[model samples]
Target: MGELKLMKGNEAVAEAAIRVGTDAYFGYPITPQSEIIEYLMAEKPHERTGMVVLQAESEVAAINMVYGAAGAGKKVMTSSSSPGISLKQEGISYMAGAELPCVLVNVVRGGPGLGTIQPSQADYFQSVKGGGHGDYKMIVLAPASVQEMYDFVETSYDLAFQYRTPVLILTDGVIGQMMEKVEVSEQKPRWTDEEIAKNTPWATFGKKKDRERNIITSLDLDSARMEQHNHHLMRKYEEIKEKEVRFEKINCEDADYLLVAYGSSARISQKAIDLCAEKGIKVGLLRPITLFPFPEKEINEMADKVKGILSVEMNAGQMVEDILLAVKGKVPVEHFGRMGGIIHSPQEVVEALEQKIIGG
Candidate 1:
């Protein structure tokens, strides 16, 4: 166990990056998530750990910087809000296509375009499905608390390097701005040059006499080669789905109804579960930790045991579709959401469950 400290989610994330010994961080400022870069700059990780922290002129430039650093086998990361993340989509896609390992954090805000700076889960589809063009996937982790915000940085980096793919931490403004107690882990030193050389033979860190120069590019001019690359990516995704599905099941032993949510919605839905229990409603809650390799098997099994399921979110019903697919009509599934940065109360969620699942 590490020392516990009270901190905001954004600050926890930045501090955790420092402890995790991230090689570099490149990001542009955006409201709700700006605190991340601000904290990093104030901490001056460059002085302490030789970590580079740079604020680019634009999100596009920031993500491209991440791509470059990651190609050289550096543990780099970037953070932004919804609109800024949208601008970085092209770079994210290119990194994925090139099979580069890196971390991306999206403290989501409401929007089709610059909607609001408040918290939102509206980017569910974009985060889980391919946000950018291509047959690709990012290992997406959703953090529900300040502790999780701190913890997932290391988890994201481990998974990214393990799979040789990009990883995304999909949170929202509520978690980003909210204050909570977090137990931060001890600091670890960054990889040495010898470690990098021995481990990352494919990285383009200058040609050595021992091996050919490594090239990192998404461009595959030959049709057959491109198809082969796509097939390889698909296989990797399938392997991740098989091995990395993570979720939390609460009070599911004898519940007649279930609540499904993730990230901030999951935190609120837990309160709803307690409220439902007080009213003699045995309502369980299933919180997905990994959005990309979604807890489909657990959800499907719960669908058979429960009479109904309610999907609660901060969006206009994006994740509900995945819930429906998982349930497969074995039990009725309903959606309740508040969009445009409007957060729903726990009581409100309980009422929606009563009307849509219990009463219905």
Candidate 2:
């Protein structure tokens, strides 16, 4: 359907950004994700498609730049690792409250601090449960492979502008750095001023002589108005939960045991399922593609079919709690993980399932 290339996950993200008719990108370099910026700079999308790629002074500055550009109704984005993402939280909250649409890619590394440049899924709680201080949620997409890392950029932007909210492409160091064959879409021209004006009537772009000027701000000193705004946000979230929940089911039809995971964990669990099959164990995998609008309903359904659910993650049992609530105690929901940037193997996952869910 598109041009194919062997590219690293981070490079796919950068290339996809250019192809998606993106107006601008502002980001700072962090390991595991630095390739995104590097590829963009080397490619010089401005020369090819009038795309602007600027390395910001800091992650905070980059996110604010995205806010400013997105306000102008331009397709904009930024990428960073975990700690850098933390620095951008306030801006992310501002973007969310203002209802500005933009794509943010977080190639997760380790920890509460600078944990490690190696892969880790420790940011699950931060990503899905509102990392910034507010009653705000980003549409979080957990991409498992380099192809998904490439493909989700366009999907994130589509969701962002459709809902007029920020969207996140959340992956980890392994996916960001891993190389794979990806089919990239052909580059499209950037949106013209007239096109932007027509498509995004709410955008704070140059107000036409006939139309009323758009006012964009998240600040409301009036408690009543703020509460009303919160209500509106909640309504939007409910609609998204109904409409945008995405997931993948592997060998779930007749599985006796299930593995619930996402991102790299999901990929590992797929192999673990094969290992389980070889052992005459019927293990299935339920991968949540959209972490925010999680596939809770589907998981609840799976609970009725499977004997137990093993929440495989790279954190300290973060997503396990969500699975627990989804199952509603209908069956066993246990967690297996390795923190501090240590990746777990398929054998390890199989062992955890045998001991924790079945043997326990």
Candidate 3:
């Protein structure tokens, strides 16, 4: 609720989770994001706020623990890096199917398989397209700075509970490892026990005390039931598509070209925007806050006014696909990036824009 103090993105996320009254946290240590677990272990939310915090055996165990906690109608969360997130896929799919609400943070590292310990934004498609098996959507928030990481921790919790779905805070090594100023609020109680008992009937605390016995399972054996479940999921996705999209616009009104980016890559893109202006090039940027429920409609509208779109990212071209889909054939859409723990600098992005939009 106040002003900035220097902190790391991982620290901000861990602190934010505690401040927002998270009921439980389950996690496995992964590079970059491991500090989150370290913070929880050191702070001991249980002693201070009575929140549950546990270090799981592996990424798989951690996500399933989140499943158990969320099913019980308690606000829960977990954190991991790229490879760990990949391991959580099956559990994520089940959570989505059951419409359980929870928060997940991926402090991404380079990866196709143990790619590197350095920061990378390569998980764009996995997060946005539903990393697990099934036609499900997760509300994905991409944080570009340490402050945004703090903000997203609380926002993600709210989105999950409001939509009765899982939400992901998609960040990378640069944001996770770098330190920056942050403002965190005083601790607030999230929910009353009465509120939990009243709202969360599907929780698995056993129905022996006159409460209706609730079974938390994603498996709908009957064909008709499965179809109904799918329909319900589709409806939720449509609602999110309409209401949950979030993006940042910078001088787009007079832009001749648009630069699309997110997470840490967008931070560099902002610098490039300033340089483009200095060089007399009219360019703008679209920084997506919600990577899932992508800011497609907004980009589509901009496509009509702009001559071209450039997607800048740490990965080669994951998010570019979505940008292209949004702009379609209305304008030229291209991609510029680096990978394997490398980052795109402002100078590099500016150079790409010159060749692609300003000249060739």
Candidate 4:
């Protein structure tokens, strides 16, 4: 077993990046997630592991830096909260379009515009569905625990490089700020230049005499070529959907009702499940680990078994639409949320389940 240490979720994420040999981190400071860059700056990963850590002038610049670094075939990453993430949407879209590999962490907070530093899942649509303008998809991983926060960093890098696309770690402030015991993996050495060249031939490194110069751009002037590119992207998404769906089912063996949630909401919903159990209600929890390649198969199968499903979140019902699509109206699925940075307690979630799903 790896060494266990008590750490905050944000700290765990930063340390995990170091353990995974992330080549660079370019991010702007934002509340609820600033710990990521702060830890990197304090730890001086450049001195420890030769990893570059830079605080860019703005979120826009930070993401563009990530795009540039990732284009050079490096394992790059960045972190931000809701509003800051919004500012990086254009750069994120560019990364997705160019099929650059990088990891983005959204320690989500309340928002439409500068909402709150408190936790919220309001960015579900923006994170899972295309955030910026274009027909592109990012691999989204929602970590429910501090342990997952540590573990998913490595997973995100692997998936990003495997698919040649950006991967998002969708978490919230509650998890980011909370402290928990985490077992971290062994430190990995950074990829050598030879390894990078061998693994990422498409990367825009200095062109050698043997091969043509690599071009990383989303632009396609020819209409027919653009259509072809779109088709290619769709095929990639299909492959990701087919192979990468991940979710966790808890107490679902003979459950009568189900709670659908992810990240911090999933943690709270687990408590809600226990609360419902005390009242003789067998409530199961289906927590999606991968939001983009959603666990639709598991959700659909559970929808057939459970009498009702309660989609719990910290927003005004965003992921509920995905649940609805999965269930296909086979069973009743209702959304229960507390918006504007408000977090719902376990008791409140139980009440909502009874009022919105079970009784009503």
Any residue pairs clashing in model 3, and if so which? Answer: 1-185
- What lDDT tens digits, residue by residue, belong to model 1 across residues 1-360? 899999999999999999999999999999999999999999999998999999999999999999999999999999999999999999999999999999999999989798999889999999999999998999999999999999999999999998999999999999999999999999999999988887677899999987878999999999999999999999999999999988999999999999999999999999999998898989999999999998999999999899999999998899999999988899999999999999999999999999998889
Off by over 4 Å in 4: none
Model 1 CA lDDT for position 360: 95
Global lDDT scores for all candidate models: 0.94, 0.94, 0.91, 0.95
For model 2 the TM-score comes to 0.99
TM-score to native of every candidate shown:
0.99, 0.99, 0.97, 0.99
lDDT of 4 by residue, 144-232 (tens): 99999999999999999999999999999999999999999999999999999998999989999999999999999999999999999
Order the candidates by lDDT, highest first. 4, 1, 2, 3
Query: Where in model 3 is the C-alpha error above 4 Å?
Result: 1-3, 208-211
Clashing residue pairs, candidate 2? none
| Backbone clashes in model 4 | 0
Residue-level lDDT of model 2, residues 278-313, one tens digit each, is 989998899999999989999999999999999999
Poorly placed runs, candidate 1 (over 4 Å): none
Output the number of the lDDT-best candidate. Answer: 4
